[model samples]
Target: MNTRDWNETLRSLNVGLPDDVERLKAAGYYEEAIARIDAYLAEDWTKTQNSPYSQGLCPHMDVQPENPTPHGVDVLRDAMIAQREIMRRIPAEYTWSKADAIAEMQRRVKDFTPEEFEMLDRENRMDWRFVEGEKRYQNRFASTLIATHADLARRQIDPPAQPDSEKERCRRLHEKMAEQGSASARITLKASVGMSDEAFAAALAKAKAEGRDAVHVRAWLPLPAACLSQSDIELEEFTEEPTVIAPENAPQRTVCWEADLTENRSFGVQYSYRNTAVYTDPFDTPSAPEQPDFDTEEQPSHIVFTPYIKALAAQLTAGITDPMEKAKRIYDYVTLNVRYHYQPSYFIHESLPEHCARDRRGDCGIMSVTFITLCRAAGIPARWQSGLYVTPDEVGCHDWAMFYVAPKGWLYADCSFGASMARRGDETLRQHYFGNLDPDRMVANSVFAAPFTPPMLGFRADPCDNQTGEVEADGVGLYGDETVSSKELVQYIEE
Candidate 1:
């Protein structure tokens, strides 16, 4: 299948499971569910033929009538995908038994009891699901419980402290930029000084790909692009010569390579870039009479304006007219209300912002998308910006947002960081993130849910954002279990 066909198939997986298959799976009859799905796939149902599974498979599934009609095919495919997702979610995600969870909690909370655990479970403070007729909790349930529940946080003993150096770095950067008046003024005054030069090496582990018997393997690794805050990008080296390197300003930039399995099983790229910090106090700038309509409209798949989102936006921005103020309110709502939780792959989520808003739990990218969606719904222009959070001590995937407000131009919002600040009771730093960003970033994507330059023929590991990397073998996508990604910060220099 071509890229378009594969993309359609990926979207069709979101149609949901057929009723019978769903019921079977929910009752812990996994093997029976698989058998029913296989039986469905084996049937030949034409458009003229009436079958219990034919209706509501897909909106356009009735247009074509082959031996096995489009509706039958779509249903079969959706059922198979659902089965695979169910299996994938069990062993890795829901691993902790009740005793295991309580034992782990006791390590952190003094005299933790089964009764307390039951109460927390009743309040839905922990993430748990049924697996093989037994209740199992997620691996991070204890941490999430403490993070979200105030009483648990207070009862916890000796939580790890945030490094003072990190706090000082943020404070120094903010003070230096605020002294320069505005983001633009800060950029101009620093020009070449107070910039961070970072080098990162990303690789797909060879050991993970060693046993697969495939003729060809293809890979794409993120490369830093030229943006307002990032520049002087250099694609210094690669394990093998790249087949294509995306243009500097590509929304989702990547360095791509293809090789025979016999020749190479792993791929890697080493690159470096310079990032300058920019700070804008939205309160200090006066808004222009007219604002551009850019990024102020809904973008489907994730950044959509559903009724709940619209109502929430209306309530947040009620009795307020200034775009900047509306944007700040949206930011505050996300940072203060949403608790950070590690998520599964983005491919599994149908609507990120909606899920986050309703569940009140999400990771960095989810919170960023939620902020962007709410901002657009409130008539503020907001967009996505993500890649890596590179610091002197650590390097990892990260995401944040950017909003436009007339005369102030574009500003930044890192809701995840702001939420951390709120938890720490640092109001000043929490407010600082509303319009400013640190220089410890590497930006490779400027748009959300954008296709790669040379699109992958199979489904992407993460269709929404490219952060870690993507790899495919023989037109089949390899997920995190089949692939290993590593990021090492080679150099960090302050200029």
Candidate 2:
């Protein structure tokens, strides 16, 4: 299946599980739910006419081409994903039982009591869910609770110490940029140029299926792309020659390779890029008479302007007409309101922005998407940009937003960083993120939910963003559980 068709099919399918399947799974009858899904698909497979399941046939199931019923296939796929989610992701993430949570909390908090745990649970500060009629707490619940609850954070026996060296570096960088001039005098200032070299590796774990020793494996790993703040990208080295390297301008850029695997084989690449920090104060610049409509419309499946989104946007931007102010309002709403929490995977989410807004919990990408959606709904042009937060100390996937104001053009918004600053009680730096970004970024993608140049025939592990990497074996996609990836900072030089 081509990229466009796959995306359309994903958008067309309903997000929620089938009623009977959901009921069975909720009741802990997982096997029964799987059986029911298989039965439904088998029935649909035999249908010759007058079947709703056969109406929209997608020939990309990665299964038998003769059985190309997307409705049933998608239902089965969703069911399997749910099964993996509950059995693998949820269990692995939420590893604490009631007793375990209590023990861990008491160890961390000198005078911790069961009553405090109950209170935290009541306040919904501890992330937990019922699994098989028993409550399971998230593995990071204690740390998260302490981080978010100020009083708890103060009372801890040994409070977790956060590293501030990076923050100070960013503050100094912003200060240097701010010294240039006011936004009215200089609409955009790019300073603190830095060059970085990084190496990344990805490999598929040996498949568990019988007699699959020689499976044909394919992989796609991200590579830096040129953007306003990022440039001078060079693919320096590779462990093995890649089959294809995406165009420099591809929105979701990647280097692709294929190999027949007799044993576990790692594919690696080394790349260098130069990133420049950007700063702009929208408050200092007057709004243009006419702002461009680019990126002001909805992007479906994630950035759609549903009724709830429209209502929320209207409420947030009520009586506010300035485009830059509207964007700032949206950014402030997300950063101040939403709590950061680790997510399972983007493929599992039906609408990321709506999920973040409704749940009030999301990671960096979710917050960015929510901010982008609200900005667009408020008649402001906003878009997605993400890759890695490549610092000398560490390398990890990160995402942020960009909004276009007429005179200032595209200003950056790192809602996650702003929220972090809020948690740390640093209003100065929190506000800085609304219109500025540091030089410690490697941008590989400028568009959200974009397809690859040579698209994968099977489903992608993350359909929304390609951060780490993706792999497929013998035409079947592999989830994160079936793969391992690593990113290493090779070198960094301040210019």
Q: Estimated TM-score per prediction?
A: 0.81, 0.81
lDDT of 1 at 231: 77
The list of candidate 1 runs beyond 4 A from truth reads 1-17, 21-43, 47-91, 107-110, 146-165, 181-214, 263-265
Expressed as tens digits, the lDDT of each residue in 1-495 for candidate 1 is 344425434444445577987787676556677777777766656643754336645454454544645446664485465445545445566778999899999999887899999998887667666777778887788888777767877888877675557667677767777886432111111000000111011112332365644345678888888999987777777877888999999999988887764333466777877888766678887788788898988776578888999999999999988899999999999999988887767765678999889988898999999999999998889999999887776777899999999898999999999998888788988999998888888889999978777887666778889888887666666665556677777777765
Query: What C-alpha lDDT values do all the predictions have?
Result: 0.76, 0.74
Question: How far out, in Å, is residue 188 in model 1?
Answer: 23
Q: For residues 395-458, write the lDDT of model 2, one tens digit per residue.
A: 7899999999989888899999999887777888999999888878888899998887778766
Give the Å error, residue 397, model 2.
1.6
Clashing pairs in 1: none
